[model samples]
Target: MAVRAGLPRITARVHLDLLQSEDGRRTAAELTRRLKVSPASVSVAVNYLVRHGYVRRERDPQQRRDVYVIDDEAWYRSVVLSARQTLETARAALASAEGAGPDDLVGQRMARTGAFLERISLDLLESADRWRMLLK
Candidate 1:
């Protein structure tokens, strides 16, 4: 499944999908049982998901374990994050090339790329804002 999705790990792919499902909000033990993976594997994959802002972990008041949650806007957040990352990277590249001649191919390309990413990021952010307002 992960391979077909171009994802690096099966655990990550499954974990994310699971979090979006009705059976999500599970503890590590639950994920282990559901995913049929080792506890350590689930832990590592869940950690990765948390790091990427793809999933959130919340303490379950009645239990010692934490619940893993995937927000309804998780995918929307991911898209905006990707756009922001691209824009930031492009800006960094252009900034680094600031000392170069304007006619320099590398600098020119960097500037163009930065502008393109900036536009894309802005559009995505606007769309996200609209979605939020509409969802409210």
Candidate 2:
């Protein structure tokens, strides 16, 4: 659902997840087998990710089979950027209400909502750090 809302196609995220769990970059045949999807569907999704800069493809030197690599940094950045945008929008709306008048009931509610968004943004940022730490 999140991938559908973002720049990456849903299948791209699935492919990325699979590649990350597996030892090496995956071939279309392998992906088709693992995902149980048609070759055409996998091709379209891979092409979309490649075109959108979320993945890169390379041919194996020995076998000449194409392998798709997930751009982990790009994936991380995309998620972080999205989280920032969501929090910023909430903050902006809250700020507008607060600026109208602090004593207003709407302003008070907005202020509370703003605090909640800020906390959520911090937690999300921290989660990325923790994820990286676990990898280490």
Candidate 3:
């Protein structure tokens, strides 16, 4: 999925699995074992996330290993920003139809579509807030 999305393949797996896991944190070795991928692959994904400000590296107090943690702000910003972009695109589509005939079927459909997109965009934002509360 990550590769298809133009991101490193192991990135989606490691990050999703780690965040879904009980502790929501994992060492490189743990990710390697759980993902059944090479250490290099895990390292590549972790390094990318670290550089992108999406993940943080923390030294394990008891073990001589680094644990990757998801950056809440970064994740939130990514999702919200994506939703914003989608909303903007929908708005643009509506703007393009501004001069269309009022009785045109396509214009009416576009208006409905824009309303739906706006509603879904707001819903996504609300859902993000709810998930953050759950994490807290």
Candidate 4:
């Protein structure tokens, strides 16, 4: 499911494992051991997840290690991030269409694409809000 959403296979697996964890959090070592992958591989996957707002890294001060977490808010954050990115792309497409001129067939196509993306982005943003409310 995470892979279909654009995560790499290993990263998706790591995310699924974390989601199934009792506390929605796991240490890097635990992830490596559970997934039967190298520590480096776990690290890379978690790093990618963190960067993309799917996970957060917290310092386990007592254990002197990092714990990766995917809390309820993670989904909301990810959706917002994705929506914003899509909206930015839509804006760029629309601008490009304007630069291409009104009579250009390619420009018309670009305009339509931009409108579609903009609508999808707005819908995602609205859905995220509704889901967030339900989660709370």
lDDT of each: 0.75, 0.72, 0.80, 0.90
Residue 87 of model 2, lDDT score: 89
Better of 1 and 2 by lDDT: 1
Selected candidate, larger lDDT, 3 vs 4: 4
lDDT tens digits by residue: candidate 1, 54-133: 77899988877788887666777777888788778868877856756588998888778777777878888888877875
Candidate 2, residue 44: lDDT? 87
User: What are the C-alpha RMSDs, in order, of all predicted structures?
Assistant: 2.6, 4.7, 4.7, 1.6
What range of 10 consecutive residues in model 3 has the weakest lDDT sum? Answer: 93-102
TM value for model 2:
0.59
Clashes of each: 0, 0, 0, 0
Better of 1 and 2 by TM-score: 1
lDDT of 3 by residue, 1-136 (tens): 6578877668988878777878678889889999999999999999988876678899988987899987667677677877888788778757655646557888777777777887888898888877875544
Candidate closer to the true structure by lDDT (higher is better), 1 or 4: 4
The candidate that wins on TM-score is: 4
User: Once superposed on the true structure, which residue ranges of model 1 sit more than 4 Å away at CA?
Assistant: 1-6, 133-136
* Residue pairs with backbone atoms closer than 3 Å in model 1 (clashes): none
- The top-ranked prediction according to lDDT is 4
